[model samples]
Target chain A: MKNTYTDSGAKDTRSGFGAGLLELGRRNDRVVALCADLTGSLKMDGFKKAFPERFFQVGIAEANMMGIAAGLTIGGFIPFTGTFANFSTGRVYDQIRQSIAYSHKNVKICASHAGLTLGEDGATHQILEDIGLMRMLPGMVVINPCDYNQTKAATLAIAEHYGPVYLRFGRPKWPNFTPEDQTFEIGKAITLVEGKDVSIFATGHMVWMALQAQKLLADRGIEAEIINIHTIKPIDREAILNSVAKTGCAVTAEEHNRYGGLGDAVAQVILTAHPVPQEYVAVNDSFGESGKPEELLAKYGLTPENIAAAAVRVMERKKH
Target chain B: MSITKDIKELEAWLPQVRRDIVRMVHAVQSGHPGGSLGCTEFFVALFQYIMDHDPKKFTMDGRDQDIFFLSNGHITPVYYSVLARSGFFPIEELRTFRRINSRLQGHPATHEGLPGIRVATGSLGQGLSVALGAALAKKLNGDLHTVFTLQGDGELQEGQIWEAAMFAAHHKVDNILVTIDRNNRQIDGDVSDVMDLGDLKAKFEAFGWLVAECENGNNLIEIADALLLAKSLTRNEKPVVLIMHTEMGHGVDFMMGSHEWHGIAPNDEQLQRALEQNPETLGDY
Candidate 1:
């Protein structure tokens, strides 16, 4: 069945998280929010304003904040920790691994300002390895929703889920395309546009780029299947396998590094399930530096044209 | 002195607990025994007297009960032995410590569905914050029950402890007790030489905790009294801490006065000599 989507506008995904957290506070009294000195940046100020008592300002101590969030779960409080992606995973991976994931504590680690799109702030704050780090954990649920509406829905949705989760979002105000009241099913991939020629799988901000790539490929008489694989861990294997089985080739795109991001995840699915030719449109093995978001995306072969190029290359690899 | 009889019974249990610590580590040929032996009286006093808990059901929520968290998970021997003896689980389970598929992991973890552990700890400096969170939960629930946790003196070197310390003081998580096992010994050597936790009491005091020092943490009466005193100071809108001065190895002669035994499991001869020092008060597991 073919599916279609239309972009409403551009909005930051972090604002979506903020909106969802505020809703969660109203819906469930047990929902608590903790921020590590980046409430404004993470857009968690709304939840803080709405529920001051439940909001905890942990003041840049990400490790302690993670431990505290893990502890709160024992008392039936669903704690959502907000911080930059760098601090969330690389800074306090041990805490998340031990206190939350290993213990199986119900902590929602909400990370904002992920990937090279966290432009101008440079490499220190921009973290592209978060998805890989989080997905590698034993029981952590890693999510990188495409836009504002889906991110908000994911935020609210994970609160109802009863385990540790890592929700990753970006700093840039990207395109908002998903439906407003859509039900977010964890571990389910979303097919934004349906086609039969070559499957183009993407996540996070790259979904928008993939959509543009789909249009560009269509002009050149290529019917590309563009899918949003938001939930990286516990990946939607059925969706991936079915798509690759039909298309016989695939192209994966993401704003993260080429090695451990969506490409690797999709490659594993393809090799095990379908054994198809696949090309990746992601940042090669490298660290991002100071540049504008658009410049960084183009410099690292993450633009819509690049995705279309990969789709063309992968289509050629598919032997009829 | 109404608990004089109780104190006598608790004091009598220390030898067997020490025996359990040395033997549990010796059997596994791994685990920390020095700090375990040193903190024997503290555990005995906590489970037996100071803290109000039910090992019978061992509910993690601990709604009406005092909960104890072992922050320094290396000393799981004393924790496991006391937990077993206190009837949180079968004393027979002590045999399977660090064994394959055993509930008793090398570090205390809830992943194996261990009853006493509320959070996984082996990584130092995280437990105090967890304790504070539990205490905050207690406050939120209006449970009025206290939350307790134990940490090694060396564990204070981690920055998270101080962050948690600031959180506790800034938030005034009053209904909590943190006892630092001040054996002054860590894996590398004395904590002072290893990292120099200069003036620990002053540090906690500077962080705004109502600090109390117990010069004799190995004394059951002293532990019970200090904890009782800390309890009285709780809910006054300030946190409380007990800087307990304990030996690295209290009951054993050779293991004491050295950091060598801090983590090393005693050999058969060493275990026998160590067991001979305490001489089986309530019998081994």
Candidate 2:
């Protein structure tokens, strides 16, 4: 496997969603878009401009937007609802539960501005528990892509798959490293680096941090493996087990709470199949405050240094 | 759309539907019957007399046909009865209301693959938005069929309902009809006591809806006329709403006009008394 990745550029993941949605509008007439007064923030202006008749502007009402999306599916329309991650998941959870998930509607809940990366918006806009809330719903597909290209790929991919999905992305411009022409297979993990010391499982923006951590670990002579777990629900258990079997220990990293994000998902698989030493690099059950994205990430211990430290700690806990 | 069936033939189904509603709740010993009984005339008038739908060929998309969403899904007794009697499913399925492994869930759900339900909506204040979506879908598909939704008066207290009200008006979602079952009763007591819905028609009108009212919701003629009037009011660049004034339990004497029986099943004697009041015209399910 390739051990090194080069960043082509830096771009916000929400723009990738916009590019994908605009492309979808051109490709499929059935595809429609809805936004709860955050069309520009969610990067849905291209879609709105291209498909004026198809786009629905539900002003400031997340719950109604969710319901309308569910209803749109009944008439054979594929509705993609866009909003901030907090409003998309938490504010409209019941509407999603009964109207979309339980009803089994084919609605794509595209949530941007996830986690502390939503910079200066504070805890109110930055949602760390959205992954848990969406993944817990039966038949809900929870996806948190690592970067721009992957987010775009996942957006197009979910349009093909007929079911409810919660596609989470972020606000800040991060490294664009993933393949631009990649096919995003749901529930599949991408192994970024091959190594034997420890497995570093990461999702969303944290995957970039894990890549940096791998380079840091390499300097210390530790060959850390990095796998991008983009799809949190229907998680790729085989990839997790295979990596841990070779490495004997693991470190989970995500831009979410440690309790119910990628770490817990990885731990559940490891505990059930192969018992392994694992460390978590995530928010320690605390809400984020208004600050620069990089500052919050560093203060909350979600940087490359923190991931590298967690990898070393887990390696120490590895038996033998 | 015109009422295709004779008003007498449509009225003939009311007693049997009422019997099914009471017996279904009584048999399960759980389920909401008051609202079910209250909305019997409206359900019958829509499913049997008014809606342009084929019960034998049910599809989830509901394209090219008028679709109805029950926002106040607790009243599944009436919905199930009307659907069964309309040939959406076997009439015998009414016996399985709220029973284990039955399509007739305690609340109306599309989860069990029930024939008529397009969306699961026990959670209040969501159906109007859903109906507007379907209406929009119909517009996009060039189907031109209207979408219908029923909401409980108390359900308007949920903020989502008002949000949908504002949305429907703002978007010019004109191809849908929303009927509020103004039964004036909720779980706690009179809806006035729990939380007053002051001047509901005026509120909907202010939200840019063409509002209609049915003074006697339990009467089939009034409901049919109101539904027709509401249907006529659609496609005029404004959504239509019918404020239907109804008694909580309309058919049975003991249960009528009270919130006490909103969710409780009628006991054996009460069921016997309720059955006596509405003689089964079409055989019970």
Candidate 3:
């Protein structure tokens, strides 16, 4: 299981989004991109340069960008809006709810710099609660892909999916491990490693942490299964139930808040059907400050060591 | 669908439309009839005369056809009446306004699969941006159709509207015609008393939009001509906006000229008088 996956390289997930968007620009003429003055940061410059007529630079207005994205759907065009996670969800919640989510528009809200991985921008820019806000909306597909290849695949996959979607990614260059040609499914969880001792469900950047934690648990003779739960809403319940049925305990890992992220989403699925012992390796109820990405992950208990500890703790609870 | 240029034929629908506005609100005992009556002629002009649209062939993707968006969605009595009378949906559905399990929600919505409403909008300052987006789509597809949006004078206070206003002018979104229902009234009070929108014509002009004004929005000929003028102003590398000045309650004498009737429905006797004021030319729902 340890030799099953390897890091292809280190690349920012936003670049994957840019790459996917550029591909979508050529593949689908109806695909349009709109950025709120963060073209370079969101890595949408490639798509903008390639399809200048289709790219809309909406200055710094997030709410207007959301409404415009919703509007663009009315004319049979799939509009992908680019901005930071904070501005994408919080600043334009009403606009997204009324225009995009409620109206059931085909708009992909691609948000980069999600969670504490946004690093030095601090809590205002690094939104840990965007997943909660977006997943709470009815008919909104919330996706947080793991790596550059996965992010690019998810970007292309979401364009084919009709309806409102909130595609969240990070800024820092992390381990790009997923296969380049991987077929990204919206709600299907990918089982990265097979084991029966305990299930380690992870999403976004935490999937890498979970894999590292798997190695640590394996060294301790605790075989852990790693499943990447990318789509938060319309979560892969069948995959979760099947995995947890084999492994009596679970550990949910994510860079988001513990209250309403993948942990809670998994908890609800477990609590309703298969009752199991679980522990959350996520940001506890608190705001994050500016720091290095690795330092923030360590400070917030989001590293592989914390995930392994959480898995061990959950396994302990399962023993009783 | 042919555009109705006859002001007499368009005006005939006005009295019945106004009747429907007051009656629908009176039946529900809730809804904004003041702005509904105020924008009667404007809706009639757009749906009946001005816009090149097909109500019978309504699609969510209104490709190759002019589309209208109601930004100030509270005045659904007028919107629903105009849409119903224009044959977007059955006129009988007008009875379901604001009712439980009704396609017609309190605000216009696309959630219920309602025809003629492309977006859900009770939230102010959002519709203009959506309309601009549609306009951009038309340009991208090389579709010669125009997108239209109507906003409340009070809705301009919303920050997103200014954001959209600036973006439309800056991008030279020349395929859109935005109309402001300058009814001078909001739910709280008169728009002037609540928040002063000083010199809107000059403000829009400063935003780089070609601005036109219709002094009497209740008059069919005036609104129709103004809409035609606004249409003529399009394709000139600039977005066009029509500043339509109208009384809050235009037809109903008792409800006229006051902000008190902005959201409150007329009582039974008041409804009778309102209907009496505008004799029913077309049958009511």
Model 3 residue B89 CA deviation in Å: 1.0
Candidate 3 docks at the CAPRI level of high
lDDT of 2 at B177: 90
TM-score of chain B of each: 0.98, 0.98, 0.97
Tens digit per residue, CA lDDT, model 2, A177-244: 99999999999999999999999999999999999999999999999999999999999999999999
* RMSD per model, one decimal: 1.2, 1.1, 1.6
**Best model number under DockQ:** 3
RMSD of 3: 1.6
Cα lDDT for residue A236, candidate 1: 94
Question: What's the TM-score of every candidate structure?
Answer: 0.98, 0.99, 0.98
- DockQ of candidate 3 relative to the true structure: 0.90
Better of 1 and 3 by lDDT: 3
TM-score for the second chain in candidate 3?
0.97
